[model samples]
Target: MRATIALALAAALAAATSASGQDLLLRGGPIHTGEAQVEALAVKDGKVAFAGRLDAARRAAPGAREIDLKGAAAYPGFVDAHAHLSGIGFREMTLNLEGATSIEDLVARLKAWDEAHPGREALSGRGWIETHWPERRFPTRADLDRAVANRPVVLTRADGHALVANSAMLALAGVTAATAAPEGGQILKDAAGQPTGMLIDNAMALVRAKVPPPDGAARAEAVRRGAGVYAARGWTGLHNMAASREEVATEEALARQGLLPVRVENYMSLAEGGEVLASGPSRDGAGMVGVRGVKLFMDGALGSRGAALLAPYADAEGTGLIVTPPQVIAQALARARTSGAQVAIHAIGDRGNRLVLDAYQQAFAGDPAALKAARWRVEHAQILSPEDLPRFAELGVIASMQPSHAIGDLYFAPARLGPERLKGAYAWESLLHTGAALAGGSDAPVEKGDPLVEFYAAAYRHDLAGRSGPDWRPQEAVSRAQALAMLTSGPAFAAGREAELGALTVGRTADISVFSVDLLSAPFDQIAKAHAVMTIVGGKVVYEAAR
Candidate 1:
């Protein structure tokens, strides 16, 4: 049957090529290949067989599938370099606190949720951006206690860096005033130094023990939903930032069932599971899924003052937290290096970024050959001390960043860093100028998981609140072309899959995203509404929204 189908496809391709000189000639569309000059593109078997004028493209593959683009635009299928896939799909099922600006709003939302759910065990949710409120601070434990009273409730900040829980939650987790602070974490306390519901960095582990883990079934469904959402947005693939072995297995199962709408590059939490460390990145020899690297969280996020910074936060007056101890990071890097698996270390703060870079530098012996082509990534790379920016390029580390973060976080970053420290935040243009490769991501549930939003932020550097007046040091903003590249070829290069994906070159994989609007010339605000008309992967139409 497979051979018959192939023969039929070949015949169709031959006929199409003979008649029109191409299998699928996308005539006259502005095809941005993440390269210079947005040109026209041609495709065959899901790969760009040729690109340019219609006549030339048709001549290259005569009598092929002819797609009349009618001046519509096309770009590469967005490559989200970092995102917690399962985490996003389940965000709706959890305690969401993304945009509750004030304490009253947060309490109201939780109370409503609690009332609706009735007999639910506890209140677990996310998406509370109280930093922008008139109070401009995190909610205290005393505040949370009033909302839930008895039920153990734990809510995550919008940035996914901090947690706010109630007294019941603290009691349930046995976190008390006597619970001493961990090495790199802090327990929010009252004036008398008693435990509060808020926890930062390593201190989150205190209440984390009480939150029940998602079961196998829930994980499977989350992965399924995540894949659907990705494909719906014209994403042919994703690099699952930090997932466990079970998540990998779930993705593998979905891939086997041919249910996974997008191809996933699964990185592991462990260096080795079985004898597989020596063999290489696959559990059961599935081609769609790959486990090539391990993810390590070096520090927490900046919004929560958990990112390890060189100096203390401009406002908070305290150094950011280092979630993972230096020794642990060092050991992990060494293990990952020897095991021949790539490592993606999450480092958002200056201190965290420097520490991870130092670990990589130390483990790899500063020798290119010793690292074995392992594309070590400093995920987030949000805030870098000026001195450490060059190390990303110098050490051949990939700076995997989420552009949406810049725009979203800009509302409060100025206050966090005052003015002097603002230079180090979301320095994409600086990173690129320094000859470093940038991998763009959404960070999923942390952001909206929208490629257009990321592109706009990368290109414009302005948050929704309109951080106008140069948009937070506009010099550090990347051009639209560069932004597209970061989401496309940059990540492809980081994953070592540039040869197969990323560009509209022949013999490469056929994964494409056809947009309804010209991404290069599209108005900034309208970008969010830009539609993906067609999403083809491996020469098959996975998603096609009719005109």
Candidate 2:
């Protein structure tokens, strides 16, 4: 029965491709429609006009400009299911310390930035991780003081859940040993009971509150720059996580001006999204930007040892912190249900995942229909209790995961959780086997935010260096087809736009991404090295690589 339906759809598509009047014709490569490979595709207005034979597409769109793929691969547009768009732009603008090999290197970069911009009042930078540092410890205030003794220096960790503030900055924030860490936060201290300048999770807000906020102009530019970067990297759209209402407005303004190169679906932060939740979802006139839901954090990231865990960490002492209380999550769920808004909560540890699941189950008490209809998601569903694996599918919750995290975090995760808990860490294939849909993303700024890298990571389950340890669980890696769907249809399904945005079918929006290599057939190692040849959104060419 399904075979007959598929054949009829194919025949209808063939007939449509034989008709006339399209705006663009794409040929000369394998065009994958998530169902079959086609010789050509035609775009009319902003939707797919046809997908079939190359000769028929040429006849159907005689007046259309043709795009020769030159052996590149084309597929339904890739949408990052999770990311921080503005942060990606800010990383470009700020004192980026993304690859500092050691604490001294990080300090040297800070010194260089400080010397280059001597007039600035304070120093702020991000993207430093101590995981691979030779010293094997987080940076300290004393370390940064060597770079800028007089000025306040605050540098955030790569995970965005922790920061190291120099003594000057700590004094400016009035944080001392006597100052108590807020709930769900930690202020690390030395044995002498002095503040060590490392703040985890909620505690980072203390120093951040002291930093000057970016003005409206700066904020707008970040959005613009971030969108351009994503488009250039071949991303057709992104699910912007932790977006502010102001950021949403900025995106809408950009879309109105036709300055936005890629589609944006925002999940505003819970603190700033009350109005949006009450008003329901909204989209720009051109359908380029939309506010789809609200984002909340259940726990901090695993790298910082702040992820709420069921058991104590193998290396650390505690069970980790809970950033948001269970009651708050329950209230948010209830509100989302009433307002018809989706809820995406960040859950990274076993305890965190279980708490979120518990809240969801409680909210879904007697309404099985609403449970599936809500399409609620757990962002970064990274660590989980083996027992709770089936709960995601049973509750109809989406697991919006970033493949790069598995490859990156595995470097230190085994030591943190021990081998006993390794079974449920980044278990992508396990979740899928249990009937849960997994949406893929890069978590940009946090990771490199490159689609090709993300695809490679998902399929290979190894670090960029092509290395993996025994406890890394390489078996959790997905197939090429599954990875492709995660980047396309899975995200569409998660966002409740599957009918209109996921595939290259007639009447669906014409969004396509062309890459240098055939992602499905390329050698695993070569996938990450491939670049984006072109990016198209709504039939408009947003980015094209030069020959």
Candidate 3:
């Protein structure tokens, strides 16, 4: 592995040296440099030499490595601002229920999985959501124990925010009737007040321990495969949201070994133990697996009604739990500020959003210098009050959102939020109008980690499946150009990598994706069909679909 990375680095340097004097240029195609001329690009030393007239590129970067755009709309390499890579990587390894709509269907899939893997003692799988199904109600422990009797079974909810364990699994975790819910989490109980194996928020850890820990090699392999999966779909770089210290180490090793296909913006959290900054900042990470941010969950998700809301969910009388409380926020912020790390907080509900914004505002208001360099992030930003919309730009925080989520969650959001409060939901364009640079993402496993789906949702403001006629907020929809910037320069800025990656201009990394169809001209639905024909990272072809 060391030899391989050395060889690749040597080749990259050789290419940079060879193209030092004479420039490398690509002409004819229209380029979107995010803020500059929409023309050709001249590259030298793997950086953009010049990006202006076609004639200028030819004159400057002569004899340099060149790629033909072939009339395709060229923009900066895409950056998925938020995603669950470990979840995406391991999705195939588990019982995936991304689209299961019925309890019967979910049970059948799990039964089939258990039947196939005979005598596998403990069984695990994911993908069960009562909200999207015809019969919308949370599944109980009996539901799972019935399928796999005595085996310790623990299946994660579609969103990594929660999980459902069987009787045996609960026993293994020592979760009984007397178990008390942890701060920022609740243990769902049966009618008899017994633990039902339905764990939310911090309660998931109780059951998670019973599951075998994935080895470093296995996780590394999973992450590498996950990167390849995204590259094949036109993703040049990605934000690995809420990763453990060990996962970051694995990705770092993979990148150092030249096995990483995608540029990862690693956001760390001290999940079970170890300090994120100490364990990570120890390694500067160069540009491979950069750990400059920390992830904090302010509240739970909207699907499970665990998302903290000012008012109770219209569907459920209970209000959502506030996952990360004030004290926790202050404590984490202290660590982050001291460690010189930016923070990314997950705030989905109104109260959650308000609280996170308030905490950040207080942190900044306390010492303006603290935020100048950190560039904190708020993941999801799913639902927000109009009053709190501009808090992002005001505090210089980035609203790292997943466009696919707006449309995907719309089916049930309105039902829970009611018509009165619906105005504040999925307000992407409003955030932009409020002067916030939106960073686009897929949120992966939670929602399919497809860049195109994100683009469709952002630009068109509609679902690929076409749930609503036009879009939820058609007037608020962002133009393709604006959406492109969110996925590119916006995230680039978020990661503090604007100068190096994102854009395809001179003095920047040569990370590019060539799509089969022109992104600008492709019809709405055709986008989902469009695939990345060629993916180049650091002037090397990482993925190219076979003709």
Candidate 4:
């Protein structure tokens, strides 16, 4: 049967190659059209031209470059609904301590980096989490002081919601035990009333502002490098959360120069997006770059105990901090309604989610028409009150989530929220059942930013090693089909490009991701092992794995 199908596909491609005008043709393996499976697909002028039987596609587009799948499967291109592109690039260029096993290991890595770059005045890095550390606690200033006491050293937690600074950095920032933390932030102190050199949420600005900003050239390079990395990893596009005005300008410049490898939908940070919000959303002519909305934070991340919770943390003292006030969220939503721009707010805890939901409801109530037009998103939506789950659908809010977060956070989430709150933690399927839209993402630099890993995390609901604790709530795992949509159509809908992107239909853009394994039929374990064979964006092949 396989041989027979191959012969037929070859004949169809031969017929297709005879005519002119079509851009490309793909055949030999399954092609998921979002509606049904097809044998072949053809592209023309960057849009899908035909999707059906190989012979039919060939007749429809008789002169296109043929790409044989070679047993691989093709689906609508995957889009990371939430990510930080520049951070991904910076991660590549800077010191990364993502897998440090202990505080000593992290300190040693920092020491090595400091010695290697002795010419630099200050040191900065990110991607360190202490959840699995043997010490079972957050790193302190004394730990980093051992590495580089002379220069300022600031290392951010993996969640980006907090940072631990060396004594030098704390001194440079003028942060001391008497220094009051800004609203919606925390300056962790020792029992003796001394600064611990840990700053959470808004408090991080003190040290961060002291670090010199990167030049325009470096900023542009970061955008270019990040886009290339994502394309090679099978992501056709990304919704860049917390994008700065400078980064948006950098992306546009790269797109204009034809240097960008993948599509980028930018949601600028509230602090830097005043102009974009005033001007409203804008897209490039080629559909490769877009300034879509504003990204706001409702609270910090759960890992750092900064996420605003309704109740005190199970193992800690107080409820997480509210990073943004309800009045501020409401004001942003109102502005977004008038500007015709989407709003994507980061909310990780039950209280944070509730605040955002309430603001969205009030904003919608005032402008029913705007509400219908606005496909506003709640990024992370990691932990939600059971009652607030249904409100997402009621308000037509998009739950922009990262699956890898669930898998990684599960290791420590049980302790952070205890068993009862775990019920609402990472409740993906439950949200889906409530008719809420869930757009999947990787949140790279924080996570690995690999589409395959995200898919595996969502479908299996297990750690990389396939472990799942009893309280991990394996029942929330989504079906493979649902997972696929989350990365494709779901993101497209979230970005308001459902009519143009996402599906492998005749009218949609020719963005397709061909993978080594058939995701729909492969064993759950094999999904993560699968690699991208070919990535097609806007009818152009961006990345192809070496044969």
Candidate number achieving the greatest lDDT relative to the actual structure:
2
Number of clashing residue pairs in every model?
29, 0, 6, 1
Between candidates 1 and 4, name the one with more favorable TM-score.
4
Best by TM-score: 2
**lDDT score, residue 343, model 4?**
91
Q: Write model 2 residue lDDT over 1-547, tens digit each, in one string.
A: 3243233323322322232323899999899998889999989887888899988887776778898999999999999999999998788778888888999999999999999899647788998988888999999999999999988999999889999999999999999999999999999999999999999999999999999898999998788778877887788899999999888888888776667778899999989889767877788777888888899999999999999999999999999999987788788788888888888999999999998888887888999779878989999989999999998998999999999998888889999999989999999999999999899998888888889988998999988888888898988999999999999999999988899888999899988999999999988778868988888888887777665
Ten contiguous residues with the weakest lDDT in model 1 = 12-21
Question: What range of 10 consecutive residues in model 4 has the weakest lDDT sum?
Answer: 12-21
Ranking of all predicted structures according to TM-score, beginning with the best and ending with the worst: 2, 4, 1, 3
For model 2, give the RMSD to the true fold: 7.3
lDDT-based ranking: 2, 4, 1, 3
State the local distance difference test value for candidate 3.
0.75
Give per-model TM-scores.
0.89, 0.95, 0.89, 0.94
Candidate 1, residues 94-191, lDDT tens digits: the string is: 66677676998888888888887776476788878775688767887788876778688888887777788888889889988899878778888888
After TM-score superposition, the amount by which residue 439's alpha carbon in candidate 2 deviates from its true location, in angstroms, is 0.7
For residue 221, model 4's alpha carbon misses the true position, in angstroms, by: 0.8
Runs in model 3 lying further than 4 Å from the true structure: 1-30, 36-40, 52-59, 64-66, 69-71, 272-286, 369-373, 469-471
